[model samples]
Target: MAVLDIKNLNVAYKSRNEKVFAVDNVSLSISEGDSVGIVGESGSGKSTLAMAILRLLSENDTEITGEIDFKGKDLLKMDINEFNKIRWKELAVVFQKSMNALSPIHKIGSQLEDIYRVHEPKIAKQKLKEKILSLFKLVNLSDRVYNLYPHELSGGMLQRVSIALSLIHKPPLLILDEATTALDVVTQGQILSEIQKLEQDIKMTRIMITHDMSVVANSCKKVVVMYAGKIMEVGNVEDVLIKPTHPYTQGLMKSFPTLKGEKKELSGIKGFLPNMSEKNKGCIFAPRCSFVQEVCHKVAPKEFEIKSGHLSACHLHGSEIN
Candidate 1:
């Protein structure tokens, strides 16, 4: 069975008497031990989907209707108390800024110990120390850095600490929301290598949320392309990245610089994402698509099977179906 399955998920926030849609009618699935990348331009609803899965969005002001099934259980239906039990133990997240995620006032050891003790309260002091030390080593951190303040560490070191913290409870699913965005290129490469090695060792499922296509190419086996709150394409990483069928996906690939092959000037996609407050009557990307047809501006396209395990939502790909 797939480890995570989202069905007909929709997320909208109440804003000035109107509901602004951030994620709309999206569905996806990830199997155990699969590394999936969610990639899109800014305002493409990638982060919103992550927040929805984690139940971090404000309930009172947000309308979220969906089935977020994790391991056969609907996370969307779970109560706060019940969900809390699974938050860090079964599912953990490493946000964008590592420094902000860490407490500025506390020592690294204390903060890590606090998190560890919450899940294993009865663990003796010596055993806990050993566990923390092992984790630090796993992330290639020295023992001396344990009692240091957050500001004492470099950006790369702090990111490693964040990764260590996420794995402290051995959660099967780890969501990285732009976890490497703040670091230098070298540091980002190091962290990606560490993640790749760690995944091999633990066989954990990971969801890497980033706008960088190169990052996805380096780390993920599968890729999902989103645009204007809906999925545009999803398939194996190489297939989706190299042979993108959707106009939006193809445009995104053209905008990035590829390391291999002859170098060419990058071309960016034209037009901006439409305002979320406006109700979409047809294809959300119709205005920006270079291949947009009259039918595209009048009717939204249904997802069509391009090949085995590959799907694209585009009127240009095949005959439209109800």
Candidate 2:
């Protein structure tokens, strides 16, 4: 059975009396223990999709629709009280900025205790202490740093703390939204490796959201390529990275330098991301696509199944159905 399933999910923000859609008609299903990566450039709505699933977006200025089924339960329709029951215990998120997540004035141990006490307030002090210490050890942090302030920790340590917090209750589903984007290259690589190991050890279904295609190549088993608030392509890591069907996905891989292949200059895609406030009838990426056709600019393309699990949304693949 699928651990997380989203059907026709749409997320839009109110801006100057206009709605700027961030995620448009995205449907995806992730099975148990699957490491899926949603990759796209900034403003591609990958992060917005993550935030929407977590119910972190403010309902006052945002309009969200469609079902977000988590293990057979629709999270979007869940009441606040009911949602809180599983928010951090069964599902958790490690956001992009780790340095700002912790309070500068408080000790790490105290803050961690507060988080634990929220869900398990009746637990004994001794048990809480054991749990905190165990989480610290699991994240490779020394027990001595437990009492240290946020300012006392390095960037990498702070990120580790963030990860430790997300795993506090051993969540079955974990989402990391650009979790390691702020760290140095070496630190990011180390953390990505650790994340992979954590998946194996804890058997957690994870969603890794990032703008870098390389990150997806390193950490994810399945990859979803997003562009202009829409999913352009999705397939297993090896298939998507090795043979991208969508032009946007191909351009993304072309921009990244490969170590195994012959040396080639990084020729990034032309033009910038389109404005999200305005909805277009045709393909959103049509303006920048090298293979843009007359039909691409006149009508939107439906998702075509290229293989068993591989799908791409492009007019070039439309012939498979029509």
Scored by TM-score, the top model is: 1
CA lDDT of every candidate: 0.88, 0.88
> Model 2: residues >4 Å from true position, as ranges?
318-322
* Pairs clashing within candidate 2: none
Q: What's the number of clashes in each of the models? A: 0, 0
lDDT of 1 by residue, 1-322 (tens): 5999999999998877799899999999999889999999988899999999999999888999989999989999999999989998999998887557789899999989998888788988888888888888777789987899999998878987898898898788999999878777876787678777777888788999998889999889999999989999999998888888888888888899978999978999988999987878789999998787899888999998988878999988733321
Residue 181 displacement (Å), model 2: 2.0
What TM value does model 2 have? 0.94
RMSD from true fold, candidate 2 = 2.5
Model 2 global lDDT (CA atoms, 0 to 1): 0.88
Deviation in Å, model 2, residue 208 alpha carbon: 0.5
